[model samples]
Target: MRITTVETFVLSERQLLVRLGTDEGLAGWGDATLEHRPGTVAAAIRELSGYLIGEDPLPVTAHWQRLTRGGFYRGGPVLGSAVAGLDQALWDLRGKWFRAPIHQLLGGPCRDRVRLYTHAGGPPGQTAAPERARAVVESGYTLVKASIAGPVGFLDSAATIARFVEDLEALRQAIGAGADFGIDLHGRVSVRHARRLADAAAHTRPAFFEEPLRPEHSRLIGQLAASTSVPIATGERLFCREEFVPVLEGGVAIVQPDPAHAGGITEVFRIATLAESYDAQLAPHCPLGPVALAACVQLDLAVPNFYAQEHVIDLSSAGSSDLAILRDPETLVARSGYLDRPTGPGLGIEVDEDAVRAAHRPDLLVPAGNPSWNYPDGGFAEW
Candidate 1:
């Protein structure tokens, strides 16, 4: 079937959806949302649609190569996100045409159910960290993660390090030893702070220390990995396999590539395979909408090295906005901390077009950008 139209909708300030319609009437959906840059990604999608208008939608890989490499300057988060949405749409079309799920098209399932992890322990300095951890564990999540919230200085005092360690220990104790807890530095800490925090939290044994150092300081990941026993996990910021090479070689135990911003299913699956060769695991980073989570679930089922899945929304919650946009809210809900294999075609979840369109707000098409912060001395601080 030839491509007929490529449409993008800014469903919310944080969610962007893409729908690719074909002459044969089969349409595929994808999420290309780039936090704080929805407008830029939407424009990128429109620009890339020029090459896809009359092309066949079944040749997913070929289309991916051209959409990504066709441009002289390629592979940043915006371009990767644009191509990622289109790639997901192409794969969805291929799946529908072949009458199979995307995972089956990728050589079938590796596991019966995909394990998922959710964020807990609200912003740092909250006294309810343990309570939040207990709440998620009681809800049937065996794994949970929380970020080192708020601004962090380059050389913060011992009190800063102690608070993080105390928080992690509390989460670990709250969940009991049977469950696992992870800490996300969110690229907000320097190498020195990361080292100190890792050393102090080693007793708690976090599932992984995510993005301890920013992407720019990735070369030092191996050195950092050598210093701590904790597993080093990163890659929500790194866009492609080329960018992942150093981290993989640096002994990063888990690679968390976001399908939405890391070339969708096509590239994330490849990234999982690349990580597999290095004896690492794939725990895809997905903190966006339902379509993006569905896309990540497909990869989790297909890749043998799949470790766990990260999600911002509580899939089991009935009132979550993430589920409101779907035709079947239960499509991605986890049972016993795992999502059963989806039997439906494509990404396996149906997007409620009416809900999506209704949720679209023109004013929200352009995000106001992420929050910024400053140190006590007035120096800029990472948010």
Candidate 2:
């Protein structure tokens, strides 16, 4: 079928929308929204839509290159993310046309079910922190990822590291050796601080350490990786393959690509390929919404280098306003630390249009201070 129309939706400032309608009445959905730059991404998508509207929707690669190279100057969060939404929409349309799951279109499944990991186990708590971790373990997830520390910046106190170690060690003990624990540093610490932190945590033997240093300081991460046994992981901030080259060549144990932000399935597949060349694992950063998670699952299923996925299984308390419209409210059900392959067509999980409408925020979301730190100078700090 031929292309019909291309439209965008910005229910609120934090959401970016790109929908492609076809003559056969088939439409595909995509999200390229940045924190507070929904409008910017939307406008970028709108401009790029001109190149796609009259063309074949199935030519995802052609469209991708045109949008990316159509302009002399290219590749950044805004452009890469804009192209990502359209790429997702196109893949969805192609999947529908072929009447197959997105994975089949890629090459077919490599395994029976996709594996997932938990984001619980912070500090000791009967409340939202430690309580959540205990609950997930009780629910039967043996592989769990927990925030070992809150927000720590350059040259912080060693006591902070001690406190972090104490809390994490408790989590390790409470869960026992039956589970594997992954730690996230959130890139707030400097190299000096990361070296010490890595040394301290190495003794606990975490599954891995994620974003120990900020993305910009990535070059130094390799040095950190060399200094300690803790596996180094990063990739959330990187928007394309070019950005990932240095890190992969340098020796990262795992690479985290957000399908929603990293040019969707098309680019992430490439990122997965690139990571494998370096013997790095793919975890896929996905703390966003379901469509994004669904897209990630398709890629994860098709890739052989996958380690585990970061799933926000409990968004209810977070209100997960976007979740209200998910095609399968039960899309995320990690039994033994693995998210099963989606059985639906296209991205498999449907987008909640009504929920999308309801959750729309006219104002974009800004980066607020670290939620853990309520202090005057703004607690230690981590994203």
Q: After superposition on all CA atoms, what RMSD does each candidate show versus the true structure?
A: 1.3, 3.4
Question: How much lDDT does each candidate structure score?
Answer: 0.88, 0.75
Error of 1 at 319 (Å): 6.0
Query: How many Å off is the CA of 129 in candidate 2?
Result: 3.4
Write down the worst ten-residue block by lDDT for model 2: 121-130
Top candidate by TM-score: 1
Writing each residue's lDDT as its tens digit, candidate 2 over 322-350 gives 56667576655554556667777888867
Error of 2 at 67 (Å): 1.4
Can you list the residue pairs that collide in candidate 1? Answer: none
Task: List residue ranges in candidate 2 displaced over 4 A.
Answer: 11-15, 121-128, 148-150, 313-322, 330-332, 352-359, 363-383
Off by over 4 Å in 1: 317-320
